[model samples]
Target chain A: MNSAALPGFDDILAAAARIAPHAHATPVLRSRSIDAIAGCSLHFKAEPLQRAGAFKFRGACNAVWSLDAATAARGVVTHSSGNHGGALALAARTRSIPCHVVVPENAVAAKIAAIEAYGATVHRCAPTIAAREAACARVQVETGAELVHPYADPRVIAGQGTATLELLNVAGPLDAVVVPVGGGGLASGTAIAAHALAAECQVWGAEPSGAADTFESLRRGEHVTDFVPDTICDGLRGTLGAPGFALLRAHAVKVLTVDDADTVTAMRLLWQRMKLLVEPSSAIALAMVLGHRQRFAGKRVGVILSGGNVDLDALPW
Target chain B: MNSAALPGFDDILAAAARIAPHAHATPVLRSRSIDAIAGCSLHFKAEPLQRAGAFKFRGACNAVWSLDAATAARGVVTHSSGNHGGALALAARTRSIPCHVVVPENAVAAKIAAIEAYGATVHRCAPTIAAREAACARVQVETGAELVHPYADPRVIAGQGTATLELLNVAGPLDAVVVPVGGGGLASGTAIAAHALAAECQVWGAEPSGAADTFESLRRGEHVTDFVPDTICDGLRGTLGAPGFALLRAHAVKVLTVDDADTVTAMRLLWQRMKLLVEPSSAIALAMVLGHRQRFAGKRVGVILSGGNVDLDALPW
Candidate 1:
């Protein structure tokens, strides 16, 4: 499979099989109280309970295992100080492969500690995109390890799609599926899987209004990267990836933007009512569902709870 | 069949069969990261994710459904401002029967709202125990509803035991099972189930140091009820009921008491590491396991996460 090409249903299918032994088949949960509030039957794909505490494990596990023996022996590298970094490191450990993470110097201490805890070597660069990329490139050149771009890589996107594939299979049929859009990897993968398996299932992206690049890009018919994100959702701050954008565009996926305040409210609701400790990024999907009741009223909706990694001391509420 | 008698393994089996259709058979989850910290393989029976957000649902469901057609039609009543009231209300809703809760006026509005949301009529009384009991008795007389004691009744204890019964079935064999001793319903039931199913399996009760009634009772060879509770584990503050004390004493169950500080820390760890939003009461079991590593080291320990109903605004940490 080409690394730069957009991932399709076949790629997702292959990725699912590849990561089956490594990634968790997370449960699809429901909350009647939450369902009543949204006026829709909700099937929440609980990836918060996934290995490494997020759905990122699916893609990371896929990418790590998809490598050839010689390539895998060389190890894998990525530039992330969040769930993806932790996930990739944990995935590499399963295969006894070395993992390198080029993290920003200003990354959260806890997140960096988590990456290190997973037995990954963390190389800190200046807290700038260019410096981070240069450090990653340097690591790749020096270690001869394959670079796994968090969401931009075809394999990663395909891996992320497996979550939706499992969700669709477990949830039966759904009128629509709502997934939180970060760099659009999950959204893109979800679109591919839903389109192939449930043609009638409409795919929707829930984006934080503070970082609505995907929504803006779709509205303008092009990728946008000019805005700075100021939302409480730390994971959804990344600009839209090109492969993810292309796939989402091809599938005509709708984007729903939600306020961070509303995301916090939804997050609290999830915690208080459903007993789920989902992050703001994940809760944003539910926020979108509740915010737009008319679009999903009385319908069976599948919601992808993207992750559960949160700073206990720095809660938005 | 005798409400006053201590429930046996047979009663638990009956409860398991009775509540199978109404209650959730919650998953037994494992966290490798958490296991590494505790130096033991921990199988967490997640009752926090149970219907009505606690193991109380099992007992409540069993009691509500155990009623004959005429008795059930008359409705069921309980006096609680916590999980049991909500669980009983929800259980009654499943049978489409009227339910009444006698709650103190000083009870948390959120909890009262939850019980009401489950379609139970809330009967408010003064904050004193006598007043609450009087009010509950009045409701029993007025509505002709059967009284379902929170943890003392045989049917309730039998119902609570079903969680451990399911845990053993899913988790296979375990060296021991740790359960929080609130009113002792869950603890009593757990002891019966574990002793009957796996006679070699030891049963340990985790109680808050501030509310160490069960520990004191066991130490003194009699029930204790003189201490003023001061723990963050609100659910474990109740005086151990006579039936529960007798059952625990007969089973020779050991009780481990944990400080509120340690319980808060454990709760935070559960939320952060496992993505499980367990209350301090639920987390006490893990606290006991971690605190007494020597006892549980290298052993397979089953920890019942008693409940997940928590006040987000009033997080102990």
Candidate 2:
């Protein structure tokens, strides 16, 4: 749990073994149209088709299963009402343990319904980050549930890394592996995985111009905590976690930022060309490549499509 | 191309071999949430991920390849402004032959752009069916190009059947194979493939209630062609072809119709739950299963998501 000694590929391997039976080995998709547009051969690791419609399930599964039977019996709690909460809820269901989600009062009904559908109790809190954290703390005190901070947890990062591990194993050596950065769980894990598996492969992080904290942090040589996020990518509005930042800093991962407009265009292109319903955050990875075609031209690049939980009524286009 | 001399299992086998070198073996997707909602174990053969974003490529590839070298050297032509025209154009390109497409003047610019993007020369004609046919005939005469009908041709039907062949071959065994019916190209081909590969498997056709000619014709034991199609499923607006009808009748393929509203709802649900961007026609197949749960409940059902060509600017929902 210490940033000084982060989890390595060994922890990722252990997470893969722990979550193998519960998690899906999602398909790797390729599109000639996309290849032509981006001027690169793209291997899309489709985590949108994962158990909870996101890669968060792998980490949630590992974190839930890592607990001993006695500790897991008390259940787990998280301050997320997004993909992580739903994933955690489903992971808890698999272990037959109680799960509590602290959701902001303004969270979408459909998302809350999805989390509740996984049989997790929902606790409503004010929309502020502090309020959500306080509510999560209250749940932890009341139910004696273990808190699984969405990205800061080392087990969650290790679980997320397995996606890149599987991608490298299946797609073989690649020019680079691109991932969308939010709290940096997936990006840090992927950097570690690519380093451990394919040393020759470069690791890059994509961020929305609106929520470019990760890019600015890597640029300024330290984490920048203060920022007002403004991005349509709901799953990627959180600040980068300390543990995830340490890993990214240690690995010297290059972070690229794309405008929200380009992210929307990329998302539309993905839906049209690849027939994949990926979120705006996931599209940023491809946007980064398309915007930087000179760098990735004629190379086989692996991109992780993080999630697919979208509100149909409130479409961006 | 003749109704009396319809294609059978042998033709499908030949088609599989012919298209193997050109077409993609698209992945079959599974979703736990969809299964829970539909009360069936569904194996979705995702043809949207196929080349040209539809199963049309399989038949187009088969038709182009079925022609001898001398005949293919001349070229290929078709009257279509949808997935079929694009598929034939790409197929012709693969064989290094000129492709001519006769499109109605009122066809969407996006559809025409996609067809032209594949290097097909577009010949504009009036929106009337007779004008389109006359234009297509002119192209055939002038360019000495073979006329490949969208779904009526025997070679095309056999080509379409290969999608089901691959699905059955990969998904192992299924209780039934469901497909969307327009001109019955995919439906009849799937019926034939199911008969050949899995005799115990029942084959059903899904159609839009607004365009229920296939259902009416099968119910009345004849081909019916005097009705206007009125559905959001643009891919399924055409009448059932004579040869396709004959094959369906011979195989006794049952046709079920779902309302356009239901098809749209199903399409939205697929995007939300399965992370798939499927057209309304493709969604009808799953709508049928969900609408008639008694028939598909507790069974392993195979449904072909026929295409992913959607107008992002004008979504039905």
Best by DockQ: 2
Candidate 2 structure quality by residue, lDDT tens digits, B215-295: 999999878999998998989999999988898998889999999888888999898988889988899999999999998
Per-candidate DockQ vs. reference:
0.76, 0.88
Which candidate achieves the best TM-score against the true structure?
1
Model 1 agreement with the true structure over B251-289: per-residue lDDT tens digits: 999998898898888999999888888988899999999
For model 1 the interface RMSD, in Å, equals 1.2
Model 1 — TM-score against the truth? 0.98
TM-score of each: 0.98, 0.97
Off by over 4 Å in 1: none
Q: Which pairs in model 2 have colliding backbones? A: none
* Docking band of candidate 1: medium
